[model samples]
Target: MFLITDEQLDALLYDLATLYGYDFSGYSRPMLHRRFNRMFRLKEFSGFEDFRRAISNKPELLNWLVAEITVPVTEMFRDPEFFKVLREMVLPAVANAPLIRIWHAGCSTGEEAYSMAILLKELDLLHKSILYATDINPEVLKKAAAGVYPQNILEKYAENYYAAGGNQSFNDYYTSSYDLVKLNEQLKKKIVFSTHNLVTDASFNHFNLIICRNVIIYFNQQLQNRVLNLFDASLEQQGYLALGTKETLQFTSVNQQYQKPFPKEKIWQKI
Candidate 1:
């Protein structure tokens, strides 16, 4: 097994953060080590110092490294039951707001953003809502802004869409051609995709709802607390926060600051 000593890891992280501004310092050790190993194998680097030098010299290589580390794996209506809970329970609380701002933090490739837009449209609230989808990886953000997904995945997405309490035909949202499925232009209008790093970046705007699913699991407890505090600051009073099924505010610093709206669904409301 390839080994990266603590000194080597620290030096590499410092170099990468100083050069590229992508901080992996707060990520879990085991996960970061795995990513480092994979990158080392792919680049054929002799050691951590060599990899660091290569990354520092090539800015483009940093981008590729960010992509590899972030693991932008997402799907439309990824958790149908979660969406079902949102539709039936949480949505009604914010349905009457004149204007709404929904933040999808760590929204890898805009599937969740588009899924949210579809839900808002079905509820007749799309025109009044602004969805901000943010991720640290520019490559995925570019694809998300383009709103094109592989056509082959449509069948599975359709199943999820229907299961998530979709009001109408799932096919109505996109046009499939060749090997790509392009999301509807109207649906795209409501989404704003941008690059925002949760670790190093400050909160941009207050949001009525924040969905940062499956993201904080990669962070250590301190970083998780920091991010949870940031989310707390960004959320409006009584605003919603949705986390991954595996994640929880329990035992964290912000646990008392927010109460679970649906414990089973992992939805929390700011107190």
Candidate 2:
């Protein structure tokens, strides 16, 4: 077990940003510490200095480090109630939109993006909708663009699909082959996957609906406020914003900028 002092931890974070341009200084210390320790152990580094040397020696390792720091574990139609609320309320508001633009921020592996595509297809709005699925990790963006997932998790995916008010058999959306399940091409065509860092990247386009679930908890309050401000800038007037159940804008300075449609759901509209 590698033990690190607070000063050393701060220095390490500085090195990551200075050397590799990967910043995690604004992240929650406990969460960052846990990930750092786990990475140190997994990489079998003698100490933080050794780990820093390794990163310096091999710049490619920064990719792995970034992945470790911004780890994302997500599923299709996660938090079923969230999607249920979207289908019942949000979808209807934008149903007649000539060009519906939905941004799935921090989309990991594209599960939820495809889930939204499926929902839109069912609602007969997919043909006019464009989904932008983005993440900080380019590696994950590649996987997300492929629209393939491990076959073993299909059961859970199907379960979540149904719970999120799926209209047809979930099996119809993907093809199973060997150990992989590739989502149908139609679903893939609807989404555009790209690399976007919520920490440092600026918003490129306005969106009608922005979904960023389960990604802000790792960030400190300051970083969270910055990100919420960015979201506020990116969303169109009266546009929708959905966050994870554990996340809320209530305590943030931008809380009044958004109005919650339902107390049970985290769905908010820019006001």
Candidate 3:
């Protein structure tokens, strides 16, 4: 196995950013190193230089690298309590609106977006809601738009749904076709999946609520603050912000601009 030196890693990140605009410079080095090393081994590269030459020869490899690096490990109703709070408390806060726009920032494979759709449908808000599910990976966005999942994962997701206060049979939301399950057409229609990089992209629309969970941990504090500020800007006054359980705004620049309504679940409201 070849060891990747710090200088080589820095050059790789710089080259990727400069040549393709896929910047990983703001990402945590240790995390990047781990992911880079994993890909290096998987690709059977002799060293960093070999990998760099390969990327130079086939530029599209950068897209695969981006997908691997930012690939999200997420599930439907990931933290059941988070979705529980969103249903029992958060949705009601915005339910009265004629048109409610919610942004699922860093949405991966459409699980959380579908979870939200289920919640909105149960609350009779689905028709009035327009959900935007964004991720940096176009491939993931394509899967999200399809709203399909492996059948093996549906059992776990069903449990999450029940725990998150699902009021109806979870099976009603999807139909199995061989090895995959497709989410309901109605629910799928409520969500629009698009590719948006939290690091480099500007906010395309204002939202009543923004849910960004478990995605920013790979970023350094500086990038986290930048993203938090972006969310703050993208949200309407007094709108809601939902983050992963481990994420916090207490130390970020936007900390004072939002208040925790469901602190345990990391749901904050803009002030």
lDDT of each: 0.89, 0.88, 0.88
Compute the lDDT of residue 126 as modeled in candidate 2.
93
TM-score of each model, in listed order? 0.96, 0.95, 0.95
lDDT of 2 by residue, 113-203 (tens): 9999999999989999999999988888999999989999999988998898887988999998999989999989989999888999998
Error of 3 at 124 (Å): 0.2
Error of 2 at 131 (Å): 0.7
**Local accuracy of candidate 3 as per-residue lDDT tens digits, 1-271:** 6767899899888888888777888998998888888888889986677899887677567767887788767888888988888999999999887789999998978889999999999999999999999998887788889888899998899899999999799999999999999999999998988888899999888899999988887889999999999999999887999887788888889999988876577889999
lDDT of 3: 0.88
Off by over 4 Å in 1: none
lDDT string for model 1 (1-271, tens) is 5777677778878877887787889999888877777788877887766887888888788778787778888999999999988777777788887888999999988999999999889888898999999999988999999999999999999999889998799989999899999999999998999999999999999988999999999999999999999999999998999999899999999899888867578899998
Q: Clashing residue pairs, candidate 3?
A: none
* Highest-lDDT candidate: 1
**Clash count, candidate 1:** 0
Q: What is the lDDT of residue 105 in candidate 3?
A: 92
Candidate 2's TM-score reads 0.95
Q: lDDT rank, highest first?
A: 1, 2, 3
Clash count in backbone of candidate 2: 0
